[model samples]
Target: MSAAGQTTVPFTVPSFAGEVSDAVVKVLDSGWVTTGPQTAAFEQDFADFLGAAHVVAVASCTTALELCLRAMDLPPGSAVLTPSLTFCGAINAILHAGHRPVLVDIDEDTLVPSPETVAAAAARTRPAAMVVQNQGGYPVDVAALTEAAGLDRTRVVEDAAHGPGAARDGAPVGSSSYAACFSFYATKNMPIGEGGAVATSDPDFADRVRAMRLHGMSKDSWKRYLPGGSWRYDVKSIGLKANMTDIQASIGRAQLAALPGWQRTRGELVARYDAALADLPGLVLPQRDLAGVQHAWHLYQVRVPDRDALIAELEAAGVATSVHFIPASHMTSYRAVLGEEECGRVPVTDRVAEELLSLPLYPGLSPDGQDRVVTALTGALRARS
Candidate 1:
């Protein structure tokens, strides 16, 4: 129902405005707003939701990745295998953890690193760990990837930043991995303005993450302030300041509660998009969900010829769009580490990067807005042809 002059449709918008506002105000009134009871409650609730044994809330997914890597205690300069076609945070975490990142190419169809690719990379680099990412909320085959990488679950970390509600082979993403990291950024599946968590089944690993998240203190501030609590504590080891505040946790809890319904809405929107755009020319849709797996539908990306032109056309028609990622190898910082020749190894990643386009798909997007997007996109493709 929209026309070229109609109001613009945003790429994404956080849901439950009223609930988030109320949660924030309640936390403001509680006085104890730092990483306190609310954060603990959120951590427990999130762990329960993911069917994980333990969850440690942090300030961001990047920090959660760093925490997970640090917990592993890998040797400095050890190689960590990761996909080049993913968010920069994944690679940044590897570099920041004092490890050398071994970039791998993605499968053309699934847009994720394949088991074969991982195995090949592992064979070449003898990577100490494999950071598997669930790009765009599509759950990767973790078991197969781990087997191919010749690494046990203990050496594999799931970058589930886009995969909070996703499942693989009838198990939730966090449940199947040794450790899974999630994000609650403003635009993530669960919007908390800024927060993340590390979920793990190992109690010892969980304890280490908990300690490392808060200055490596013997006890966190919440525990130290309790009745009969000791006034003194020991700094067990050097740690990062990545604790999640109660305010963010409160918002995260509210968002978590509303997530199921929002996810349903997202699924419905994706179905609509598939139906509307299936036959469009010079376009490649995202892969369909495999049997027994649930996609979180965080991003509705497609491969199209003249991707930039389509984006410009959509913008002129008042529809907002985005790009999910630019390959890590394409970045200047990574280019210095991975020489141009090495970066060119990911042919699929480079090709996909040039053609990928993220359309507007969110809980609040209306059917009419989607129709307008489809119309604009089809028009642009036809015009080019």
Candidate 2:
């Protein structure tokens, strides 16, 4: 509620307290503010959290995906499989990495590509690499998908931007994938305002990414400036200016520490949404429970018959909503770059694009605010009915 007597609900909110501010302040005060102790500590802490072997922080998830793809050293113009019902950035990264995007269809239930879809795409293109994303924090079984893919284990990169600490069958996300890329963006599970990281199993691959993230240089600013350290470093290979700064990593460390509690809160809120909307006619809720799978709960999306009308009604009532993504096929660049035939068959992705609506969900969203969202939702549904 505000002074104008309007009740409001934001689509998402970042949870940042004094610890985040203090962490940034401490980083700014330190003479070494660029990739240094704080950034290194955050990478180690994240690796420990996911039980991953080697972790390297980067500027964003897009570049993380690009770097991981480039690390595979796929032959030029080789196809890279990814979900069509995903953020266009994933497809763009594949293109930017000098690979062709062979968009695959997603399962309607999970909103993530199924093993069947992976198998089908694999047979179609015999891709050199694939990006298996945990869309909306719903885990995609990498092992099953890889087996179905019939590709080498190292060819797959898990887009874990939504599910960094999320687990499946007792193993956390980064544990199983060849390479899992994580995001610490403003609205992500572990909010760092802006940054990302890649966790891989192979030490050699990790070393490649570490050097590649900083212009393929042998030594970073931290290593070069250490006492008796040489400023004379060698350039190893081609890389990107995609290094995560200490300031962002400092905030990310705080968010990572509070991750478990925040995740529980997200699950609780989703439960409330599930219970409240269960009886509402013509409303299709997201798949919430799967045995041995713990969701990241980054999104609480529902499929309504008239998405646009409901969005309007909610907006008028001071409630906000969002669409997870527009299908890649619908995007201008994807169509121009891949053509219709190259994008491949995607009936489910095309259909779901029109119906999906994401509601307000975040650790900072209060119970009363949730209730307000529900009330506004019910009223809108009733009117549409």
Clashing pairs in 2: none
lDDT tens digits, residue span 69-129, model 2:
9888899998888988888778888998899988888888889888888888888777888
**Poorest 10 consecutive residues by lDDT, candidate 2:** 1-10
Compose the digit string of candidate 1's lDDT tens values, residues 1-385: 1365689989888776458888889989988999999999999999989999999999999999988998899999989999998889889999998998898888988889998888778887788998989989999998889998898789999999999889987788897468899999888888887889999999999999999999888899889898988779999877899999999998888888989888899999999999988888899999876787788889998999988877887898888999979999899999999788778878889999999999998888998988988988988888876
Number of clashing pairs per prediction, in order: 0, 0
The local lDDT score (0 to 100) that residue 158 gets in candidate 2 is: 92
Per-residue lDDT, model 2, residue 353, is: 80
Supply the TM-score for candidate 1: 0.97
Write down the TM-score for model 2.
0.97
* Cα distance off (Å), candidate 2, residue 377: 1.1
Which segments of model 1 are wrong by more than 4 Å?
1-4
Residue-level error in angstroms, candidate 1, position 39: 0.6
